[model samples]
Target: MSTPQEEQARRNAAVLQAIGAQQPAQPEWPAQPQPPQEGDLWVPPLGPAAIDPTATAEEGAGKLSLAFWVLPDAVFGMILALALQVIALFGFMAAQGLKTQEDIQSLQFDPTFTLIAAPTLGIGFATMAVMRIRLLRKLPWSWFGLHLRTIGPALGWGTVAGFAFLAINFASGLIFERLGSTPDQAEQIIGPFRSASSLQLGLLGLFIVVVGPFLEELFFRGYVLRAIRQRLGATWGIVLSGALFAAPHALSITTGFIGLLAPIFIGGLILGYVYQRTGNLWSCVLAHSINNLVGFLGLLAALSLP
Candidate 1:
């Protein structure tokens, strides 16, 4: 009884109803952007590709290429540190009226050289390291293992590990001394500690316990080691990092009685491992601070002894 047009309209409506019944319901809200899948390279807002959180083991090996890792963080860092140290050294010499090379050599044993020069070098190293990581890597400071959540645990473990290392070092030194294999490097290094004024001592302690550790751990473990680990895997990364850590202290090896290279190398390995395990910079820094603290206390105690 319906008109032809009405019949066609009804048929169309029925067809549409059947299609709607088969189709899935629309989401109430707009769909969120999907996260990058595993094996996907993450392009940072700036710079080249950044770290992939879910990268496969093989892909991760080349996540940080050698050119980027070594040039900015390692080589440039060393250059910056050296340049700053040279400036500091010259300034110190000028202030003290030291003209000859011999005069500078003598001043090396002075508190100003140890306290001021060493800290200046550390400042330069740390500043350059931070700049490189932030600018070149296009990453935040937090990427360098600066998370607040891991601080307490990192510090606690670091303290324990540091004291243990000190004990081992002490025992090794005693054994070497008994065997007449050790030299008289302690006097050369610690002599300044004995003669320094209370103010100087305090400054030196501050550098050793806080500034030095923070800077060193931030660079060596946070940046260099992390990069190497990402590329070369843990074993090579830890070893190479420790070697680099020890390399700077090479001069001390010639002067110290027991030679600091082995202990420092071992310490570097331990610190690198701790950082790798915890992914926390504070842990290594605290550990380094504790190690320095023990040495500081020992120097104080020795001075106090009659």
Candidate 2:
């Protein structure tokens, strides 16, 4: 009769085989038949962690410990992106005239800013993100929660989520106004688009709805959120990533800076949660684009009135 130790060895050997790993043809087994007690598991020490849904916290923690380089990769890539953006912004300001305080204030209102913002930042971020994945992640698109197989549902559900979040975002803006934020704030965003020619509007739409969302989602949810999630558990990963998503605007130490931060932070949390649940970056990107589109349209409409 086969001893319990030998039987356990054979079972572990079978599992290793199923996962494309090799084991000794006849693995050495303990002489004594130390049969496991009831409710005990026969874990394989030589293999990677099992994918059991009921895995212990220790196993889960070990799994989360992987991808330690993810956040560092994100930070490095973001620095490169910011540097490129700053250089481009300086060039644009020089070309379009930037001599006074008023000129700097009016930069965001410039149509040229809208045109160039996406391409420069998008290219820088995308290039770094891909390179980091190739050199460090050594994983497929699925690791970033972005795979072609999930494209259809990702886009569809993402678009729907976008509209829903847009409504909530608009409501939040109204609450801000009630708390003394002026509706006049809309002009800063709408100024460039209000008088845009048809071609300019089209290009703006193409960038905002497509390029901007795709790149941001890929960087934020795919790269940043994934890295954090691998380091922390799901909830902290989502929350911290969402906070990081809004960290740029919140750098200013003014109350109004908070006003800018709040809405984006809320949106980021929801998007991060969605990415966690769905494991598809496309959905988050589509939803973000929808939010941007509706917000822009509403601002432009407000401009048309009165």
Candidate 3:
């Protein structure tokens, strides 16, 4: 071993040698965030995505924000509309002096169907107004995809979707029929028009082909769809919205036939999908109109039969 002074001299020499050596360069990181790399999974945000405050235009209401209003609005809108319909029908029956049950039972539904458009229109207008008013969080109508900017896609894609839905619905109907199901709901729909007056037929046709579809799209594909989509995400949103739409038809007067629900549900899904992709309320409306037009023409054919 060296002496203590020799050890100290060696350590000092080594330290001086290290200080004179050059260091390797440090890496310079990129300033901006890098793109997602391969094999990366997208983790969803922790909770309802907040609307960006700095955004130039209205984004949309978060799912949590809408949870309180969606169910109530749907229920109230339907109940109010239905109540109006019943009241109108009763008033008409009283006006006609049809005291007998037989006379009331024999009353045709073409006028009733045509009249339903009035109350439905009122409800729709109210909904639109309420949703757009700034006091109530002022949900932008455009956020619900109710805009004319995408008119072409809305019309073209929607019409194609409607036709496709009809074909698929027909095939599904046959399947149900094969399984001992009856098309009772389908028949009931055309039942009113069977012996309807010319003027009443024209009015009913207008309602089903135009007004009905527009309003239905405005509700189902518009507000209902967006609300559900916000909470459940796109897939479940489409599913539940469609299911909710088909549920109301469980009434005997409507296509309450269990077998018919499949087609109706599928139609709802198509409408939801179209609305989602096109982001245009009128697109879904036009698509719905196509389906209605076809059905209306078929109703005319049945009425023409001897």
Candidate 4:
């Protein structure tokens, strides 16, 4: 006859064994007991049950989707921009008979600039337009990361990135001069801003340095890069995005093919990486705008010096 304490110990051991809380070889064994079949029966263990449908659906939908935002805008803008590039390239071929840098520079028309700026603006607007109707009214502006939240970091990164690019271009020019080769043509690209009237310089600077960066970042980093990352995966996406970025700079014959392509490629990679790390367009825009402003200011200062 077991004492009351011994019986209580036996019951506790049985529950522990049923729940797999005791080692199989341990001597604290109790017979496996079935529930008295009066109402609900104890179910033996099986592996974990499948997750609920609602939980599975929520998990699937939780991630940030770049594909949903970037593809259509890029495809539309690319088609339009490519056509303009072809026309611009043809004009360059036709104008090749012109002599000296000044004559070559004179052929650049406002329409070409219009053609270039229009498609980028169109795509950016299109993306924002879609997002506004569908998801959130503030989606486009939010995509640009226009919060008072990150303004400090954005400005700091922008200044650093701008200085870095200026240094690279300066170093490249020195290297070329050392090799007795023509320095990069981007050195001359912003020369117009140096001689323009103050008002003209302000307008041009506003358009080129500020507006241009906003539009390009909105399209390239916010739209094109995101789209490519979705369709092609990150590595190829980065390469293609950078190449596409380089293509527009081909409009300037001064940089020629190689010189123009190099910086644009580097810029694209940097901007893309910035977007990847920050998950926002503000940093890229800051980096790009700062680079442009530095280039503009450097050229102006050079022109002013005796």
| Candidate achieving the largest TM-score | 3
lDDT of the candidates, in the order given: 0.71, 0.69, 0.68, 0.58
Task: Give the TM-score comparing model 3 with the true structure, all chains together.
Answer: 0.75
* Model 4 misplacement above 4 A: 1-140, 144-151, 176-195
Poorest lDDT segment (10 consecutive residues) of candidate 4: 47-56
Higher TM-score: candidate 1 or 3?
A: 3
**Candidate number with greatest lDDT:** 1
What C-alpha lDDT does candidate 1 achieve relative to the native structure? Answer: 0.71
lDDT score at residue 171, model 3, on the 0-100 scale? 87
Error of 3 at 20 (Å): 20
How high is each candidate's TM-score?
A: 0.72, 0.67, 0.75, 0.57
Q: Residues 139-184, candidate 1, lDDT per residue (tens digit)? A: 6677778988767777777777787678767776777667666644
TM-score of 4: 0.57
Cα deviation in Å at residue 265, candidate 2?
1.6
Model 4: per-residue Cα lDDT over 131-204, one tens digit each: 53235422334544445566676667666666676666667666655655553454444444434567665665
How much RMSD separates candidate 2 from the native structure? 12.6
Model 3 C-alpha lDDT per residue in residues 27-139, reported as the tens digit of each score: 99878755657986333335433322112233244333453456677777777767776776677767777778787666645445445535454464346435633336556
Q: Candidate 4, 109: how far from true, in Å?
A: 8.3
